[model samples]
Target: MAQQATPVRTARLGRTLGQEPTAVSGAVLLLPGGQEVSGRRPSSLLANASVRALGRRLARAGRGEGLAAHVVHYRYRGWNGGDAHLARDATWAVEEVLRRYGDVPVCLAGLDMGGRAALRAGGHEAVNSVVAIAPWLPEDDVAASPEPVKQLAGRQVLIVHGTNDARTDPELSFRFAERAKKANREVCRFEVHADGHGLRQYRDEVTALAADFMMGTLFGRAFARPVRDALAAPPPLGLRMPLAAGFGASLSW
Candidate 1:
């Protein structure tokens, strides 16, 4: 029988999960942008900088909103970079996070390669929402994409990409959103300020908007069509994306 993929100890166990349960407002599993992060399982986990930023920023959304966010930084074997190979692991990781939080509402956010994995993981029934930054959805970048995301159409999703990103055309993000929307899946689209996939120019703003959407969906406020449509609407040229301001939270990240 084939072995099931699992998240094991990092190359170095200096920083490890299941060591001491970290207190959190909600869990944000950080799937690395690509095999680079997966291979090294860097001792430099986002558990502190990035994930904490997201947790703290979302704190202002409301205290004890009964949410717990943790960063799922795990080491997976292999490097096929396809859903067929990684989907089961993704699903298990999502379940593990939910289990850690005692089954509270779960929200996912991924950047680059992380974005793709998170969508694949959360597209299932347990995950309540998703935020994919600079997402990569198409298998054959040069060809049309399959509707795998269609399974997630009924769930909340946020696809944020930079217009000038060359790794994958920014338009691919929209087309993915459109497919999900067409399936009647709920989604929100946002454009990061400036160009490039690093999101160096708009990381703060991007995470802030991401936090708002996450908190809203967690609290059941983001599911309304009016709100979803408002989010999905295209921002006029030069706008900062998803407006990052209307939500009743302070943008700290």
Candidate 2:
């Protein structure tokens, strides 16, 4: 059996809202998804088991490569439509990483609204890559407002979406990915067969896929061929399958 890495320390810098700026720190920063309410901070990563679990997994992967992790707790907490609150916070987080680390590469990973924010902030010069897990990118009207996604022309991006996503349409993510691919040379899309927006059914698989992609993009490590093949493999029986935790099943992709 393969041994897992130890969990890294998580630090909370401070509250971020509007144009307020926070100090720079940490290697890879994580943001959790939530809605915009009144005068309260967004939910913490600990509140969301799935996002937190994914973060821990990524932390383990980065630990093996000497990378640290941080999670940004939003001030407003909501998408706020055209307000751009979430994107603003994400950009701030990236800027902090560069300010403290001095040109060090960073990867942004998010889910749902956080995913959209990550995509919006991926255009920054300091950001080397972005991973949007089941991002809430609606294609109806405001698709073009968040222009940073267009800036991913030559950036490395990974889009993970489930075909059965109920909250955010997977087709929208697919279309957005297609457009991103036309611009990005290293853009890759991993579609989860029948999982929903939360990806509860295949959380471990999603975490593994994300960790592998992040490690490759941020550290120049080669992704395992078996895992890559499994990701590339098509779904069996039309239902999404979960990849084993260590080295058990062969990756179809």
Candidate 3:
């Protein structure tokens, strides 16, 4: 007889980035964007205005859908340029959630570099869905080498990017979504009109979209036709993405 693989237990440890927990069967793990070397996990973890905005919306929506929401503070400070440290942190967060909540389903939402980590880690058995908001990509890169595009197989994935994003190319996100579609039938791409890399204009809408996607996928919460149609819409013409305003000042990472 074939033997079943042993389940490895991860140590439960890390800072809670936001919001109180609830007795729900589902959980959402939110990751904020920042670099590794800045030594600013405190500020970068959940202080970003956009990340907090998303977290608030997710919490509200998750409450309605009976999914507990939590954010993670990385034990380490950086991504290490696509290294495993941040991904390891994410794995730890999921395991902790499972330990506390007892095998509940999980969804991940991340911005920029955090989005990259989520995409790389989304294929894990614990993650039911992933929403990548304006994830960063190396310049002119293909999906095969470092993008982890294929790892999203067998998962529902959503990639939301602004047409005017200057920090990361929206086309790369679109291509990553296409590659993910080859293995996962439930892949979606959303384009925000006239927004920048920070999604400055429609932060609330983006958060709602993520919440809707998470609720729809994990809890059978059906999205309105307008929501579905907008997610499937083509990229609209928009303003150029100006450089972000005072990144370290506003976010401290």
Best by lDDT: 3
Give per-residue CA lDDT, model 3, range 1-253, as digits (tens): 9999966533233333344555667888877676744533446434455666676777776664466776666755567764556677777788888888788888888888778778887877889899889997554445536466667777777788888888888887776666666666667777776789988677656766677778877887775454455334443211112223221122111
Query: Residues 1-253, candidate 1, lDDT per residue (tens digit)?
Result: 9989875553211222222334544544544454422444333444235544554555444344544444544454323545333345456666775565566666776666557767777766667888888876664454645637666766777777888788856776777676666664356677654557766666666666776677677765443333456555654321224434334334332
What local distance difference test score does each model get?
0.58, 0.67, 0.68
Supply candidate 2's per-residue lDDT for 208.
76
Rank the candidate models, highest TM-score first: 3, 2, 1
lDDT of model 2 at position 134: 87
Residues 1-253, candidate 2, lDDT per residue (tens digit)? 9899966433243332212223322256676777643434565644455666676777766664556666676667667767667778888888776666677788888888788888888888888878889888867455454334577865677777888888988877767766665566456676777779887777777777777777877888777664455334433211122334443124322
Name the lDDT value of residue 112 in candidate 1. 66
TM-score to true structure, per model: 0.70, 0.76, 0.77
- When 1 and 2 are scored with TM-score, the better candidate is 2
- Would you give me the overall lDDT of model 3? 0.68
Highest TM-score: which candidate? 3
Instruction: Tell me how far the alpha carbon of residue 222 in candidate 2 is from the true structure, in angstroms, after superposition.
Output: 0.7
lDDT leaderboard ranking: 3, 2, 1
